[model samples]
Target chain A: MTAQALALPRAPRVDVRSVAFWVMIAASAYGLWTLKQNSVPTMLAFPPSAALNVAVLLSCLAVGVWLARRVMRPVQAPPWNGTWLALMWGGLAACGIAILMNTRLLSVWSQSLGLEAASDWSAALTAPLNEEVAKLAGVVLLAAVSTRLVRSAADGLAYGALVGFGFQITENFTYGLNGIVMAGGVEPFTATFQTLWIRIVLTGIGSHWAMSAVAGAGIGYLVSASGRSAARRVWVAIGCLLLAMGMHFLFDSPFLGGLAGTLAKPLINFVVVMAVYFVVRRAFRARWTAVSAEEAAAGTLTEDEERSLSRRRSRRLHLRAFPAGPEREAQARVQRLQLALVEERVPALAPAEAVQPWRDAVAEARAAR
Target chain B: MDDFKGNAVHGARRVWVPLVVAGVLLALTAVEGLLAKALPASEPVPAGTVIEFGSTGQVSAQVGEGWTLDRTASDLHSGLLLTRGDVSVRLTSVEFSAGKPDNAQEMWDGMERLLGVARHSGTEVWLGEPTEFDTKWITGGLYGSLQVDTAIGTAFVLPADDDAEAVEAQVLGPFDADQADWTAATEIIDSVAFDEDDDTGETA
Candidate 1:
């Protein structure tokens, strides 16, 4: 076997088009799990307002996904090397360390100055800036060690998102435990749950990941644009870092009304994001098509893949081809698995292979179409 | 092409971690829901009965097992006139008056003595004639009323008489024509008698 084959022995052969679909599902699932394990207990405390809390959480998640899609370009070819994992874990650790250090320092300073000790804004301001910078540092480290990990803006976003997810889970756990204490038993659990819903889920607003990804995107952009001067790259990184801080400030600032006001701001942000998305879509409309063509020409897409893509054009054909039959179901599942592989680019396929029956069913449906 | 190869590799690792994490979170949420459902209901506090203190000299009322004697500004002004559950009461309009006094000193001494005795007994007392004078005797006119109505009667210790004869009889002697025509008043006094000897001494 060739060295490339040896290096990527278990790597599945598929077009990059399928990869994005899988990565999104995996990321979404992880996000959902983290949200449930860390936030549900706190939400239960708000028994009376549990439904409202759940709604808020769902809305926030939707906003996060929408923002991710709009601001970050989709990575057609994902680099699944351990570099992404290291960046994710390292980013989380760095954020934790940064928070500890910044909080201690701020506490001492605020005390000496006769200011209120760090509670909401102080932590918000300090954490978003310091922790985001730290997480961005992981992206930088990954980019330095391996040029492949952050070949696109979307790659940076994915890594940053993972890091943010890690940070969010740890933070939510603390918030949940605090809620339990405040509730003082089951009677006030509803109130506790509501508090957690507002603080952890709704107010999250993707501040950490968005800010870190902004920095990561800058680094990726710098690395990709060849022959760029080091000074120019530094300037670009600094600009991105500043922009991230500004966004963090807007997110954390109390300028917005209290809980209701804060909640409203995210919606406003979403609207603004959507508008920007349309603009971006207009600009990149041709670019995506060109990229798709290039990918297809490079032998990345098989004849079956082309047929499957065509089948999705009509809803009737789409449904009929991707029918509920075990064979079609298996093909669909394989398609999903292959798509995930293409998106995440992770080499381990045992988990992916486990879902082959579903993939095969999906693929057969495509062939029928 | 090399970049594409790199991206393909990176994309694969991203899928599984999030999926596993999401599954765990869903399970946690379900557990939380179950725990919440299992929690017992909270105990409620019962509402207590209302206890009214009409005049408020010294209110010695039974609350549960204890007798509470509350010394507040007599319900005449802004004192505790009632106790209902967790709430207290205060009468807004009320006034008191003495029919006769030998002299100003006697009147002042009597008012002070009555107030002191009431205070000692844990009952609040106020001194002032039920007249059309908008002045407070205690706080140098900071607070008082001249109105003598049913609401005022409820606050004062004096008896109420609606009969013309009875009210006229009550405002005799010391309250006669020499001092003032009590009959000119719209509301007649129940009784306003002064001792002859006391009046004589005052005149002398």
Candidate 2:
């Protein structure tokens, strides 16, 4: 079995009885219906173009999600159900909340500052505060939905990226519809393509996903049982949120206009996220190594196996030593159990006594081999 | 489950954390709602009043006294919208900000594109010959008549000082509008002027 099998020590099943589950369901229903009502007439008027826009946006979303789920997480993806929940929160709940909040906030700015100042400065003022907080709320709610869903900064990063992707796709769809009206409804299909090209192809890389990923990592740090002090976690979480907001402000602000500036802003955000990712990954690897060493000293892992177990490639190479059949299968099973035990033991999450069951299972599997 | 005990919020009270966050969001939205309600929705402008609009108050127009400003829809940044009887006037400086559709014809075409966006469809739009659109305060602008559906009204793309900005105005009314009301609307248009001295703002 793959390390994915080892990633299931925490419950993956949804608890329908939980308050979070029902809340998510209600929010999604209200948000999706409200959004549909707003967009239905336009969609009906231009069915073919609307369908094309949805198809293209959905395809982009699928690709983004596949990348995050398959390649982004450290050891394994978050549970499949949890991944869906993150998307739902971003697309439905967050966007739906933002429509109302942004409208009110914009009207306030327009009325107070006058439309003159509001037109130029309102978006830069409103979206960073309203949109970012709204999306981040979903990340927090997802954690509440499953306490085990986010145990490390890496977990937060994955969930956050998925959520952002969802928001981005839905936003693209809305923009695609508006593009028709903007182009005067004369060339509806052409207008839809133009909007998609700008929203999806041009600015998609460093948009909602990048911002939410940064904030979600903060949530992970806050909720994680990693040995950081409470104050540090709180500070880091706040720092990430502010940083995300700043990035959003830059994107919406009037400072950087034109094609080159458009390209540069997203690039700036992409680089920042990559840097944050490397830092989080480095910390996670350090914890992983410490647990591997601890298990090795207890003689649960042979010295050779301990060295090879941490890397998927090395594990595959080590498995070659066993003959094909039950022996190789048993060895693979032992490797998976060892990983689960090591993951659970890392940091302050599990004490030695609590980890004994995983260790005993690995031992029995090893003895069978 | 036992291992997760110490890890809840990294130690108890973890489940309540998200709930608290939800409470904060609810509170923020509530405050926003209250703030919006406190804003004045509509305002009345006195007759024969010269209204200075846009960022620097560069564009000035005198009202003939019947139109009530749609305060909720009006913005100092983009001019304003007002109405009197069956006639509605919308003034917007989108051209100055976007830097496109430079002529009266382009502005008229832009209106055609804007109709669907404004939820008006299957309408006929025809424009008249170009003429001078100037007032005592503003000069060097294009003026024309725009026919929408069966209604006809005057359209002006009045230029701002330094010729860097222009405000597009449309006064729409029925094809067979009242003669006295139409004359008053014309006087209102004739009063469109620009303040050449104010340079504090760039666009609406």
Candidate 3:
């Protein structure tokens, strides 16, 4: 394994011609349609409660997507379209798949084990197996859609979180609708509001987003073009997925029954994600610094440029010394190209021509400076 | 740059990934659904017999003869669904984390929404107003009737055990169904009790 080989695909680029891209669209559309069939009528039936749930959930979705993008990656977040695509896959494709699979599987358990036993065990046994795979599949597809979308574990974590966030909000909205039934429908609006808050406040911390992010990191390992051994990558991927599923099972399981227990489940999941984030961030930073050092050795980047390139604010600070207008713009372009070159660089063993495009692009920018 | 075309290709296109993922997912769902369909999820429910269920065994209700309990659809935590040849009856109870509704009328309002008549599109149906009625063992229960083009039935909301706030039951069947069907439905509704210990509405 040449420790994770590859050039970063151009940022924010989707290989639209890829089979994966089309497959994602088709599956997501089908899922979205199925969900609408059940939800739309309920919305129309009780317009007020539905509207309230919609307003609240949509607000949460906006905040979640924004926050996930800002925090999931180390140096910078994954590009916008990829992040949106991951969320789309989560909300539409994964949720749809879970609905179909869980309904069937839960019935099987109920019939086979009888409702008495199935009640305690069915959800605990089912959702982790079904929903985690469904959500992780989205991350895998994004990688398949384009190498640029998820070049590292950091990329996978970010995209995975987005996907999970999408699934979480969609699930929350569904729960709000279901909440009416649970609360006996006496106070429809109140029931909806109560359900949304409990979910958003309590479980939302660790739920689908955290679990999928873990599983997605594993996919990052599996798909990484780096030097990690094939067996190692596969094992890490499997382990991460199982870990995610375990976390989910605990969340849905009957062991912890009350309010404190409810809070504990998500807290546990949040801690696990934070651990993975730190490790992935560290690895990404290490690789980044190593690449910059190599570029400096080759006289492609000056010491000051190398020091400031990886961080946005630092880059801005470095560029501040230059006068305004054309000079600043030229220097900014050179720095941008330099960072791109570092991101797209392959290992030393690869043929020299492999990095020629990015290197040439950087040189042109430098000349503009 | 040709081999490295499309924004600098790094990895071999794993085009087969999505196909395999989707195929496996569909395949699993199909297998599970088919297997569940092949096996029955119900047992015969006899008349004038007590049925004990729910998350714990505390919740109990009497059942009428000639119905099958759909264990798969029914849950110990929430309620039960039973079916006969053409008639289906469901006895559901929810213990609200918040207290019960303020009044039977509010509960009736809940039952109306629960019937979800408005959710079914392209249907012409009439739902009658609920009237307060006294049951054999329980008093002041509310009942309403609904007809969806052909099938007709009544829905009930009754005071439950102290632990549980209330219980709701609905019986739906064809119009020509015999009085025995109605007798069985009534038998179950009259004796619907949330807790076996309380036995507030125990019948002979």
TM-score sort, best first: 3, 2, 1
Question: TM-score of candidate 3 restricted to chain B?
Answer: 0.80
lDDT of 3 by residue, A1-369 (tens): 111132333444687887778989998998899789768767776678899888987899889987887788876667777877898899998899889989988988888885667888999988999899889989888887876677778888888899999999899988888888776767778878888889998789999999999999888877776767879988998999999999999999998888889999999999999999899888888888988898898878999999998887898999999999778887877777787677665322234466667777666667656
Q: Comparing candidate 1 with candidate 2, which one achieves the higher lDDT?
A: 2
Report residue A184 deviation for candidate 3 (angstroms).
2.5
Q: Which candidate achieves the best TM-score against the true structure?
A: 3
Deviation in Å, model 1, residue A309 alpha carbon: 6.5
Deviation (Å) of A200 in candidate 1: 4.6
Ranked by DockQ from best down, the candidates are 3, 2, 1
Superior candidate under DockQ, 1 versus 3: 3
Clashes of 1: 64
All DockQ scores: 0.02, 0.24, 0.46
- Give each candidate's fraction of reference contacts reproduced: 0.02, 0.29, 0.50
lDDT for each candidate structure: 0.39, 0.74, 0.78
Off by over 4 Å in 3: A1-12, A346-352, B1-13, B46-49, B52-58, B96-100, B116-120, B123-125, B161-164, B198-204
Per-chain TM-score, chain A, candidate 2: 0.91
For candidate 3, write residues B137-163 as lDDT tens digits: 667788889776678998888865342
What lDDT tens digits, residue by residue, belong to model 2 across residues B1-204? 433532344223444665676677778788888887898655666776666776556667677667677765776655788777777787765433223334545544544445533342344667677687567666667778777777789877666555455677788899677777677777767776666443332322
Q: What DockQ score does model 3 reach against the true complex? A: 0.46
TM-scores, all models, native as reference: 0.42, 0.77, 0.91
